[model samples]
Target chain A: MMFLSFVKKEFLHIFRDPRTMLITLGMPVAQIILFGFAITTEVKNVRMAVFDPSHDISTQRIISRMQASEYFDMTQVLHTADDINSAFNKGKAELVAVFSDRFDENLLRAGKASVQLIADATDPNQAAMLTAYASNIIADYRQELLREHRIPFLIEPEIQMLYNPQMKSAYNFVPGVMGLILTLICAMMTSIAIVREKEVGTMEALLVSPLRPVWIILAKVAPYFTLSIVNIISILLLSVFVLDVPVSGSMFWLAVVALMFIIVALLLGIVISSVATTQVTAMLASGMLLMMPVLLLSGMIFPIENMPVILQWISNIIPARWFITAVRKVMIEGLGVSYVAKELAILAGMAVFLIAVSVKTFKIRLS
Target chain B: MKKAIEVENLTKRFGSFTAVNAISFDVAQGEIFGFLGANGAGKTTAMRMLCGLSRPTSGKGAVAGFDMIRQPEEIKRHIGYMSQRFSLYEDLAVWENIRLFAGIYGVPEKEIAPRTDGMLARIGFESGRNTRVKELPLGWKQKLSFAVAIFHEPKIVFLDEPTGGVDPLTRRRFWEMIYDAADRGISVFVTTHYMDEAEYCNRVSIMVDGRIDALDTPKNLKQQFGVRSMDEVFHRLARENALTSNAN
Candidate 1:
């Protein structure tokens, strides 16, 4: 009953504060909308510089094909070798495709032609995606040419988009946004909330009460847990109804996993608050320590698989990694609850461990 | 009379710095004990140890009939704490803050609503019970904080410089509230640098350089130190120490 009242009070606090409400719900939707409309994880509108020295119908046809495709945006037509570096350096071109001289003549004689692809590897991930799109377009063109020439016995590997055939940024980001926003609002915010009490000296009043330390922590974390879950559902609903991002896995399992991770985040907030003497320290520490990891390591912005081996291992331990994986499996792949059982268990374990440690630290500090 | 709080050779050291040197004191139940010290004289540290917020590095203490080290949790339940800093929730209304403290103290839910209203009314803040604590004047906030501290009717209430920034009239009103609680058989253990406030205590103890330099009724202390008033006594002792240090 004592713990319940504290929890009630916590809810009151969260509900009363508009700033907290904005961070939890408004920010997630805002981020999802921004990332969905403004950014493309699949790499579209790539600026390309074409150098077609062949001056033949086939070269022009290829350039037309490239321009017509949504993947490539023809920004420049370079005539000289010196122009290549300047085009790339000016950021006007991501890919420089050179059609060698006599390229159309060779296609008619030996029925073979080569195109040189020089890509800016500065943003390797973008470069890689752009390269894949270019390769597919070239492959399609080659197939058309072979069919026109009455070629036979040709083998081509069929490309299959295993998941997210539409490849919308919303599908890729909604789940990650949910995880990041929930952690920031639930864990980071709640941790600082308690420290605020301490700073204002209200903690002494609470401590003098018969309210147990564990109960106080529970009260502080409980409201955030509820608020974050509400945020999760709202985001999920928006993703499905508004954005048309499909849930590939069990919605029930997805919710369960999400809740598990949220609990872990809330517990982490409690631990942070227990250690921090002031609200400023709590906010600073949680923001720097939790937000960055959730943003980078959770595979929200960057692919975890392509990261260096050490960073890969580091990301493995991050709670956001499991959450992102679980959310993606459910939201993108529509995987069942059974499929994400391991991740859910890991999240639950982390939550329990963090809560236990927080309780212990609180007791030690109080004593 | 039962001893509400007792400290024997209590010492608290942080790293190499002795915040509270070996000190011993006792307060009977229902007494108003004023703790006086210059800044950094370990008054807060000693009060913390007695309140069980901090542990004594050496020696022993009991607070509210429980061993400070062995049963701090029990002691915590039986005592209330208010710091020089206003301790109520700024965003919460006066009544809400009272109810929160009451709820934390495990006041029966059925009793919380009435108790909250009663506390507000008793503090003459019933009209502004719904007003946010931050919206209230400093004097009212201090009064609300004091009322919230003893919401559970704890055996002892600890106040660390509870009236630091208030005017004399407001401080006097705050003292009246303290006396009211003491009149109800609640022991008041308070720390302050205010010499005028020190004079109102049934007994006062002054701390200097981590040790108690004087302990007695304010009149006795003034007379023994050969000073005109409590303030002069404190200044004389502190100045004498400075002169001795310079000579050394």
Candidate 2:
């Protein structure tokens, strides 16, 4: 009964502060929409400079083909090789497609053509992706030409992009956003809430009360738990309805995994609050320690396999890595619980370990 | 007379230094016991031990018939604590704050409504019951914190410099509330750095360098120290400790 009132007070604290309410409920929606539409991995409308020295039917045909594709915005046509350097340097183009000065007579006699793609590799990931996209478009055009001219020596490889046929970044980001948002709201908010009580001196009153210290922690965490659930639902709704990300597996399993991750995050928050003496320390610890790991090392924005070996080893310990993997398996791949059993078990173990450590630390600090 | 608080050589040490050194005292039921000391004099440390918030390194104490160490939870149930920093949720409405304490202290559901209404009327701010605590003046917040601390009607209430930073009039009104609680047989264990406030207690103890140098009625302590007021009594006792330490 006392615990119930404490929970009610927690709710009152959350509702009375409009800023906390806005962050808890509104942040996830904003982040999902922002990341879905604005921050995308799929390259679109990439400005290209075409150095078509040949100026023949074949080069014009290839330039028109690149223009027709959504990926390349073929706006600049360079006359000299010197223009390639200036065009790239002036930021007028990200890619310069240089075609050799060859007449149609050479292609007809030798049945061969050479094209060079020069891309600015400042952002290596985007540079690699843009070059691959341009090459793929050129390869498509070659296949069509070969089919028309009955040149049977070239072997064409049929590539199928399974799971995400159109390769929508939303498919990848929605689950990652769900993981990131849940961990942030659950861990950061709960730690800040508890630390605020300590800063305001109400924690001393709470400790003096008949309410058990563990119950005090639970009371502090109860509201954020509910808010995190609401956040999960909001993210899911926004991803599914607005972003058009599909949920192929059972919603029940997805919720179960999400709940486990939320519990893990809340336990982490408790551990942070137990160590932090002030609200600023708690906020910094949560933001710097927890948020950075979840964002960078958890395979949220970057793939874990492609990272350095040491970093990949470090990513294994981040709870969000396991969570994002499980969520993608369940939500995007439409896999069942059996497929993600290892991840679920790891998350459950982490939650238990964090809870035990936090409880021990809290008790030591209280007395 | 029944004793409300009994401390026998209660000591607390942090590593090599003693914060509270062999402090012993007692207060009778319904008595206002003033715990007075300068900054870092260990008064708060001793009060914390009696309030069951800290463990004493040596000796024993009891509050409201519960052993400080073994029955800390029972002692917590029977005592209330208010710090100089007002311990109310500023975001909560007045009535909500009151109800929260009442509920946490296990006040029965049947009596909570009447008790809350009575408290609002006593504070004479029935209109402000719905106002957020942060919106109220600091004086009002301190008073409300005291009221909430004792809302469960604990047998003893502990106030650690509860009147610090308040105006003289507000402190006077706060003492009136303290007197009212004592008159109703609630033992008040209050700590204050203000010597003038010490004169209002039924009995006062002055601590110097973690030791209680004097424990007597304010009038008797003044006479014992050959002083006219509690201020002189405190200064003489503190100076004696300084002279002794200098001699050592």
Which residue pairs collide in model 2, if any?
Answer: none
Q: Tens-digit lDDT track for model 2 on A168-255?
A: 3447777788878887888888999999998899999998899999899999899899888888888888888988887899999999
Q: What lDDT does the true structure give each of the candidates?
A: 0.80, 0.85
DockQ of the two-chain complex in candidate 2: 0.83
lDDT tens digits, residue span B154-220, model 1: 9889988899898999999999999999999999988887788988899988888898988898889
* Tens digit per residue, CA lDDT, model 2, B68-147: 87999899899998999878999888888888888889999989999888887887878998899999988989989999
| Candidate 1 residue pairs that clash | A210-B105, A248-A333, A248-A334, A248-A335, A249-A330, A249-A334, A249-A335
Best candidate, TM-score: 2
Please give the lDDT score for candidate 1: 0.80
